[model samples]
Target: MNLFPINAGNLKLDGGAMFGVVPKSLWQKTNPADANNMIDIATRCLLIEDGNRLILIDNGMGDKQSEKFFSYYHLWGNHTLDGSLKAHGFHRDDITDVFLTHLHFDHCGGSVQWNTNKTGYEPAFKNAHFWSNKDHWLWATQPNRREKASFLKENIIPLEESGQLKFTSLPENDLQNNSELGFDIFFASGHTDKQMIPLVKYKGKTIAFMADLLPTAGHLPLPYIMGYDTRPLLTLNEKEKFLNLAADNNYYLFLEHDANNEIITVKKTEKGVRLDTVYTTEEIFN
Candidate 1:
């Protein structure tokens, strides 16, 4: 199997919110925030090429949102979904699966887009089966007030309309338990309901797509949970358990939002599980 890093784009978000409860004095060293308190984040996605199936995990925030809405996030950088795919000698039509970690705009927004001439909306990966669990699909389609803003209808409905929306259910734990998809999925509810984290076996190493579970390497500490989570307390428990499991198994965590650190390995520390080693995907695999 072959893997490629697909950088959808970069966007700025408030550092305080991204590193919930953690103050500027601590996180600023790593993710230096601007005067307005916003920090640059990478909407990094992953590409899996296993024979004919080319699966893309998370497409990053798309360009469909209005100017006013986008002004808040301040999307930056030249790395786009198309450019990233083309870098690997591929295209949107070449993708066969859009494996969503969840339906948040930053993660799956690039799954759909506006057609040319502003005619209507359509699936960005025209040939891909956009995958989301049944529960996650229901939660995102019928979002609560806390997460309503992140789940835009334009991004969510078009996949189903395109007849490419398929749920990653049935076998339930499709990744870990079923030995399907070349990874085991670990479910976490603290960030959002039914957030799927793929534990992929690539090359000879076990790598995990740490969606929002640990957005950045700076968030390695258990207490560094994001405030945007619906349940902050629940996040603490989720992170502790997941991080412990990651450490015990020696899993390589691929950070989606971390602009600096691509992949990180953590070891148990007295200060509550500090980052043991930091490296790139190439180093980990090679």
Candidate 2:
């Protein structure tokens, strides 16, 4: 199987919110903020070419939101979903599956787009079967007040409306086993309900897409949780346990929101499991 690093693009977010209660002095060293306190973040996606299926995981934020909406996130960079796909000698039509870790705009925003008529939304990948967990799908669509802003209806409704939305079955007691979850249904409730982090076996390596669970190397530290997470304590516990298993098993973690570091290795230490090494997607996948 071949793995492709799909860099959708970059956007800016408040560092304080991203780091939650972590002090600026600590987080700033890893992900330094700009004068406005906004930090650049990458909506990094992954393309999995296995057997006859060309699957894409999380299609970054698409260019459909209003100018005022886009301004809030401070979108930047030359990277784009279409451009990135073309760079890898592929196009949107070739994607057979779009495995969304969650329905957050930054993660699944690129899944739908405005039709040429500009009249209504359409599935960005017309031929692809969009994937999400049933529980998370319910949570996102019926979002609570705290997460309503992150789950935009425009980026969503259309997927189901297009008749392309599908849910991956949640394996029973799978999250308990580091090697469980027959097809990788990682139940990380802290970031969101049953966030589906796809585990791809590529080139004899276990490549697990680490969504908001371990967004960046800086978040490798146990307490460095995101303010956006609905349940901060759940995230802390989930991260610690997952990092320990990741370090023990030597798994490669793909960062979806990390603008700088791409892939990283975790190692156990006195301070707790920490980033032992970092690698760009090319270095590991290529």
Instruction: Assess each prediction's global lDDT (C-alpha) against the native.
Output: 0.86, 0.86
Q: How many backbone clashes does candidate 1 have?
A: 3
What's the lDDT for candidate 2?
0.86
Q: How do the residues 90-119 of candidate 2 rate in per-residue lDDT, one tens digit apiece?
A: 999999989888999999999988999999
What are the RMSD figures for all models against the true structure?
1.7, 2.1
The numbered model that scores best in TM-score is 2
**In model 2, which residue pairs have backbone atoms overlapping below 3 Å?**
none
- Residue 199 shift from truth in candidate 2, angstroms: 1.6
In model 1, the runs with Cα more than 4 Å from the true position are: 170-180
Candidate 1 residue-wise lDDT, 92-189, digit = tens: 99999889999999998898888998889989888889888888888999999989998989999988888998886534432344344656788887
Error of 2 at 31 (Å): 0.8
Give the Cα error of residue 46 in candidate 2, in Å: 0.2
TM-score of model number 1:
0.95
